[model samples]
Target chain A: MKLHSLMLAAGLAATASMGMAEKIKVGMITTLSGGGAGLGIDVRDGFLLAVKGNDDIELVIEDDQRKPEIAVQLADKMIQSEKVDVMTGIIWSNLAMAVVPAATAQGKFYVSPNAGPSALAGKGCHPNYFNVAWQNDAYHEAAGKWASENGVGKVVVMAPNYPAGKDAITGFKRFFTGEIADEVYTKLGQQDYAAEIAQIRASGADMVYYFLPGGMGISFMKQYAGSGADVQVMGPAFSFDQGILGAIGDAALGVKNTAHWSKDLDVPGNADFVAAFQAEYGRLPSVYAAQGFDTGLLLASAAAKADVADADAFRAALKEADFQSVRGEFSFGANNHPVQTIYVREVVKEGDVVTNKLLGAAAENHSDAYAADCKM
Target chain B: MSTLLLIEQVLNGLQFGVMLFLMAAGLTLIFGVMGLINLAHGSLYMVGAFAAAATAAATGSFVLALVAALIAAAAAGAIVELTVIRRLYDRDHLDQVLATFALILVFSEGTRWIFGSFPLYLDVPAALAGPVTLPGGIEYPAYRLLIIGMGLAVAAGLFLLISRTRIGIQIRAGEADREMIGALGVDISKLYTLVFALGAALAGLAGALVGAIQSVQVGMGEPVLILAFVVIVIGGIGSIKGAFVGALLVGLTDTLGGVLLPEFFALFTEASSAKLIGASVASMAIYILMAGVLIFKPTGLFGGQT
Candidate 1:
């Protein structure tokens, strides 16, 4: 028995010494097979592309179907069954809120690739939680600032009636010190926007700012074009992303949107990312994809610098954000969310394909308003 | 809100109602004749939209796209009725619901597999694109006016077919006494298939018309399906007339409620808070109307002894 124990001890010591290259398991809960699947797919593709040759990171992706309950269940499974050291890849803010706090409380590192809800960015923030993406209100605030700068008066703002939707309008209102023509809150998954378009036409607004994301945005833009409402339409990049711009077609052309990253951003790693993403996925990458790529780089950098088992060291490394981001110079704020420049992009047709052309920074080196409330 | 805006909203409500009527007409007919609840009817609608989108992309012909939508949706419906729906005809409502719900999953996943999750573009044809000014200086999309006209024409044609044709006699007979119609040698299964196909075609037509304005994506049918169900329930299970009235009422309530409620609440609250309150309440307006209809007429407006 003593001889056998000595042999086992020697084997364990050898394994421990060889554990420097240990794989970090990341569980991604994203909408993969539903209406919102396009965003999640881009995020997954970009993340996978960034860590393509690096075998040190193992990603287990689950389709949340954009459901909060399903996201919670998946987060539980990731933490308990899969025993993932890191969790990420949630696109919707509600799903992020459903999964993030619980995962962080359980001593698991939660890295947000897309969603950055106000609650998580504020007092509910955890040291183990890091958001590579901007806060939920960042892009909307950028649009507001852009609109205010351009002397856009009497703007009609609209969004779906959900947490992020409320956040979007609130953010826009914060920086837009103009006469509000009207504010419309629509159903979460409503396709038809006839009623809303009629209201916009009659409201006599110089510009219409809407935050309808995914298919909702596509529907709204198409209908708005057909209505010939004679109002300038604007929104954040979520509505004009590369994944959806083609679907929106000419209706989206010349429309201004705000985002932290664009395909045409004159950043160090952005050109390579754009080329690599197009080569890999046969399409241009969206801001979500850029965020996903950054998240992968962030995790990889932390893993290379410090062992994930050492929570304090891993957290500190993640905070450093030592990796090169596609969005140019990127860093985390007091709230653990991105402090980055948000660019204004106009939807333009580039050689038969609809894509965004960078119109310059809407808000440079901006941080979230909620950072003051985050203690950690 | 100005009088012109109200009138425009009414027109928008009418267009929405007419679209719902197309969907409800099929659903009511299937439930009336088959006594089988096919939850996959929405899948047929999705099939139609996808068919239109694909054909439009390939041919760039709006008329051809619409024709393809009709044919594809009818063919899909016929196939589903022949292969799976017929089996559930004699089963209980719960079983039919279970089977059809499974078909929804299959259709959703299958469509996603074929067309991908990205929404396909299907814009209104140039001739129908852009708004047309009305008598009261109110401008409305010409395409919406077309939808309203087409819906009315379809309703009239359906009425004529049901009240003044041989198949209509058989259908009414089948609805009244299925076994008796079969005993009288009326090829009941064939009739069922024809009715199912017809219903599916109507749904597909609605899908095509709406797809021009909406995103043609997977799971687009389900939301409209719920509203269609409310329409059929409020109209009466098997009554086409009931479906028409119910659809119009629901559409007006939903559209106008969304517009007017916020204005009404704005009187009592701040503009932003009023919008929030009005929108939340407006979403519930249709259900409230449905409940009111149910309270007054449990069997539905036209649902009574045949």
Candidate 2:
């Protein structure tokens, strides 16, 4: 009996070692604290929800605190100590810029859940870098296109003065053929928007276009409503998200915006995602959540296609675009950025909840204009 | 170039200035009386916002939230003084800065652990929701007007308290000479606690009020804290009057610069070029104002002579 038990224990130990050897490890670094925490948390939750019940891939997570330097350090630790097969989840462009190059240099696959900086979409793009989201400038470009098509003649544009802000304006101008009445840049994360609103009111523009995200967006929308300007207000999806709905309630009502996904998307996959997320978290999922969910599906699909022991094989599988995304029939271009639709949305009152409803879809699987410069 | 635009810009500046005053007052009082550079002042502001938000959510009353914010901030101040800040009174400025910076990290992490890293929302009461027309035929937010009014009222109340109250005499005495007051048999430790609590309460009040206008999230207090530091520096580190004046100056300059810089650039360049240049300069406006003030007045507007 003792000899039989020893043989069984030896066999079990061998099987466990083989399983461990075959498991793929992914390192996820995101802003889990500070001002960006809300979005980061949503992204993390969405990714985890996608990976639920998948046993092949193991995810190691770290919080970067939204600091660029910390992101670099976390990347070093993930690469050197953990020797992760792939790295993912960087919500800010600054953090992505700091870490993605290092991950790619090490030949590790770096999947971005969000934050499509212009540099990565263009000449600086790397083969090992894959973004599951649209180019940072893509949605803003759609907004500009919608504005120009809708007969907005003279418009004032505003954004926080940053690299992303520049990308937003450039995207807006790519489609907006109308004469710009004025363009204003404010400090990043500025709490007050009274001055900008006043400027917009007096600029004599037919419409105002802005690209302020998170809290800055909330502040701007509140102040814009208060300014009582007769001009129409429009922006990208980040300006009016589920996070801001509670704060900006009636103020953000009737604000026209543009995005790839709205809570009210009519697709079966979207309906499932929304229902599941609401049932689990008791809140509506934002576009950030959808992006995050797509990322998890992408990773899991790649894992199923290739043996987790081989990093190169797993990456190749991911690049094939085998997963069914929540965004329906999406694929990555040669630049490893997503080719997907940009939807124009309007913020309207949906009962007690302020939500964005899709107005029209524009530009299907639209590759960024900057991808030509990318040698990769 | 238009008169209406320029006037609107000026009003924007005034509104911004008033907001800054709310942050600076608490900082100046603590610095003047305690002779300590409390870097964790921002954490106090954050604490106030979180307390107000949580309380409001639980009670479904905005008034209760405001009261709770004040109480929580004051209590937190007193506890911190007893536990951590008391040890730093004899330390150098660098040590104080380092310790307070650490405090900020701890406070931010602690708040995240409790709050689960999502932003909380606060709504402006219906009474202050809509817009009112200003003198220039431009409609402005009633909430902003309320903020401006609240800031003025607080400033007035501070002035009266400092000048007319008996505890104010002890505070002034403490500021003048801590050793002398202790020698005079006053419970200096308790007095210190009171002053710190008072300062914290003011900070909490600012946080709760601002939370209504902005997202109440962790680290929201940091930007306001930096602005408050600039306010105190420009106003005269320990002078209430200086904080008030400096806040308005900083606020107006920042707001106007953001509006006018792009327009200024438009005269010499295309709209796009003007925007890029204007955005860059607008961010630097407050720092430029600070530099100008320092060059002219070495001690700050209301700073006492060394």
Candidate 3:
């Protein structure tokens, strides 16, 4: 009996060694606390759901408190102590800029679930870094293109004063050929937009396009409803994100916005992703969550193709972009940023919940403009 | 630049200032009576907001939310005062500062555990949901006008309460000399609890009123807290009259500086650079005004001994 048991154990060990699935260690640094925690929670939950039932991968997640310095420290700890195979899940662009360069410098893989700052897509592009989400300017550029195509006569563009905001404006101007009425930059995280709303009302612009994210978006939408502004409102989908939509309520209804993916998108994997996310989280997935789930799918596909032990092979495999993306036919541009379609979504009431419904494609097979600046 | 626009901007400034007064009144009162630099005063504001949000979500009544905010904040203040704050009263300001700072962490984390990470949503009641034309034909948000009215009414009520009430006299006596008030059978400890609860209720009321307009999140109170400190500094510690004037001054300076500075700089520079510089300078204007006030009248406009 002992000899028979030893033989069975030896046979199982040999089969395990033969299959030899690659083990990948993932360190997720996200904003899990404070005002912006909702976005991070969605990302983390989506990533975990995508990677569920896979024993070959390990994830260590930490909260950065939305601070750049704390993010840097978390990156260092992940690199030296945890010795992670890949680093992902930074929400804020500032935190991404702080951590990505240093982490990618050490030849470790960095997959951005969000925060695809233009600097990285251009001269700052790193071979080890892959942006699974749209570049910071892609949605803004799409909105601008949509605005121009719709024959918007006079329009005002506004954003918070920051690097991402600059990127968003630059993107918007790339497509908008209309007479720009005004270019306004509000203070980052400024709660009250009554003053700015009044300015927009007085400017006599036919339409207003803005790029305020997170809680700023909530405040602006609520205040905008009461601003008595007659101008049409449009923006990037960040403002109408699912995590914040409940707070915004009917204020955002009928407002058009642009994004890379939506639950209503009739893509091959999108329906499944939306259903699976709802099943797992009991809430509709935000764009952030969709990007996070895609990040997992991309990493799983790449890890399946090449051994993480071979850095060049793994990097080459990642560039292949073999995953069935939630956005459909997702591929990386020369800058390692996403080359995908941008959709126009209208905020609508779904039963009691306020959410988005698909309008149509705004930008198809769109590649970021900064790809020409990248060597790889 | 137009007179109508300028008038509208001034109203915006005044509206902003009035909100600050709500926060400053409670903070200044607490500091004056207790001599405690309670950084955790902001926690009370957050407490009120969360309570209001939760109550509004469950009850769907704006009035119920306000009452819940008041009761929750006052009850929390009383509990904190009895259990933790009473011990810090005899300690130095540094100890008080450190202890209260610790309380902020506890309150923030505790609230997070109860509320989760997402900001709770509160809505403006339908009655005040639209814009109303002012006397000058300027289109203004009725909700903001409501805020301004509530703030002014609270200011008047606080004045009446402090001057025409027996509890107000005891509070004044407690501020003057805690030992003397205690010797005179004023039940000084009970007074401290009552005063702390009152300050907390005021902070809660401010939070509930503003939560409709702002993101009702965990750390929303800190920014308002910093400005409230400025309001107290400029108004004179412990003087309700000082808090009101100082709040208006800070609010106006911040708003007008934000608007006019860009136009003023546009004459000398490009519009974009003008905006960049104007905004940077505008944010500094309040602090600059605060410094000037300190240099000229170190005790503040209405402050005496505090």
Candidate 4:
């Protein structure tokens, strides 16, 4: 009996050390097929690239189908059945609203790779939740800042009439102080922007700032170019990223945009990430991919420091955010959202493909506006 | 809004409605003749856009792209009818709906597998690129004007084909009495296949034209498909005239409502909130119209009771 008890104690110690590092299960729920699938696919590819051949972690992925209810269901299954230590990889803001609050309320760690709803930044923020991506307002705020610095007069701003869209306008307005032209709230996933383009022309705004991510961006940029309006275009970088830039073509060229990460960031970490991503995916890595890659590195670094089962230790380790980010010099705010340097990029033609060229930093070490509202 | 802006908005509404008419016309024709509720109609639209994009990229000809769209969509429709849809014609509506829903997944995945996950770019031909200022100094895309003209022409041609041709008489007979038409040796199955293919071709043309304006990507048809269903429901189940009129009404309501509602509400609320609320309400305008129409005329404006 004495010998058996001694062996059991030794066995527990071995399992504790081994299980702490290797047994961390991550549940990545993302849109794999739908209108918004490209962003989610980039995130998944970048994430898988980071965790590739690392025996220290295991991942279970499911498609949310860009549906919020489906996202919630997947989160439930991931938490209850698979026992994931962390959850991440949501695309749309609507889906994030449904999934994030519920998962975090249940004491599970959620590191967002893409979507970061404003609600999560403030009163709804959780100690267990960390957004490796910028706050919802970061890039738009940078756009507003850039416009203000550039002496932009009269701008017409627009976005879909949704929470994230509202957040985008708020962020843009927070920085841009100019003559009010008109604020147009378009339909979500609207294909034809002829009416809106006409309105933009009629408004006589010197420039147009619109946030219609994914396919909407492609349609809008194309139509605006075709309209021959010639007014300059400005937007958050998501609307002019590597993913859909090819579709927009020359329409996107010379457009100024802002982002937290770029493929051409000129940092050693980013260069390696860009090279490895191209080598792996046979395409230029989107900003979404960089965030996903950062997420993977974030989780790995935290796990290396302390067991994810210990909530206090794991949370502290993540707060440190010690991993080298592709964005360079990424840190967590008091609210656990990224405080990173937002860069301005110009849409340029690199050979035959349309991609963004780094202009300069728009905002340095930018944290969210709502960080003060965060209690944790 | 100024009168000039209002006039421009009216044109925008007409353009939108005309496009919706093309989709509704095909959907209504298929439903009227076949009694099959095909959810996969959107998949056909996607196929058409993909075919056009691929052809344009390969051949650098818009005309060829349009031709490929028509042929590819028709071929897809005919093959689907022959393989799976034909069997469901004798079955219930639930089975038809289920099978077509499954086909949406199959076609979407297959297209993605072939063309990849990225969107394909199809530029408007240089002849139609950029906006031309109209009589009132309203600048509009030449391509949009072309779309409006093309939609009206297709509607007229479809009307002529249905009312003036011998094929039209046989189709009407098949709709009224399938067994009698079969007994009359009308080759009912062939007629059905041809009708389905024709509808599919029309959808393909719509997709091809719109693909240049919109992003040519997978699942692009689903939103348009829902709008088409709304158009048909409001126009009556199987009436071409109903589809045309209904399409126009929906188009006008959606477009005008989107432009005017925010302005109307802005008088009472903050412009931002008003715009957001108004835009949402505008999105539901067609559905609300459909509900009102169904409440008053259950058979629709032109549908007949069997």
Backbone clashes in candidate 1 total 0
Off by over 4 Å in 4: A1-23
Scored by CA lDDT, what does every candidate get? 0.90, 0.82, 0.86, 0.88
C-alpha lDDT of candidate 3 relative to the true structure: 0.86
Decreasing lDDT order of the candidates: 1, 4, 3, 2
The per-residue C-alpha lDDT of model 2 at residue B30 equals: 77
User: What are the models' TM-scores?
Assistant: 0.96, 0.93, 0.95, 0.95
Task: For residue B284, give model 2's deviation from the true position in Å.
Answer: 2.0
Compute DockQ for each candidate against the true complex. 0.81, 0.67, 0.67, 0.71
Top-scoring candidate (DockQ): 1
- Lowest lDDT block of 10, candidate 2 chain B: B116-125
Interface RMSD of each: 0.8, 1.7, 1.2, 1.2
Write candidate 3's Cα lDDT for A207-317 as tens digits: 999999888888888899977777899999989989888888788888999999989888897899899989877889999999889888888778677789899999999
lDDT (C-alpha) at residue B125 in model 4: 87
lDDT for each residue of candidate 1 in A184-297, tens digit (9 for 90 to 100): 999999988899998998888999999998889999999999897879989999999888887889988999999998888888988999999999888888888888899889
TM-score of chain B of each: 0.99, 0.95, 0.97, 0.98
Candidate 3 regions off by >4 Å? A1-20
Quick one: RMSD of model 3? 5.1
Provide the lDDT at A218 for model 4.
Answer: 95
lDDT (10s digit) by residue, model 3, range B172-283: 8776887898899988888899989999998998888888887788788888899999999999988888999999999999888888887888999988778777777877
Tens digits of per-residue lDDT for model 2, A1-376: 0001001101222233234335568888887777777788788778877776565667888888788998898889888988888888899999998889878988888889998998888988998889998889888888888888888899988888888987888889898899888777778888887777777777799999999988888877766666667789888888888867666778788888877777777765888888888887888898889988989888878876777557677768889888777777688888889888888788888788878888878666677888888996
Q: Could you tell which candidate, 1 or 2, scores higher by TM-score?
A: 1
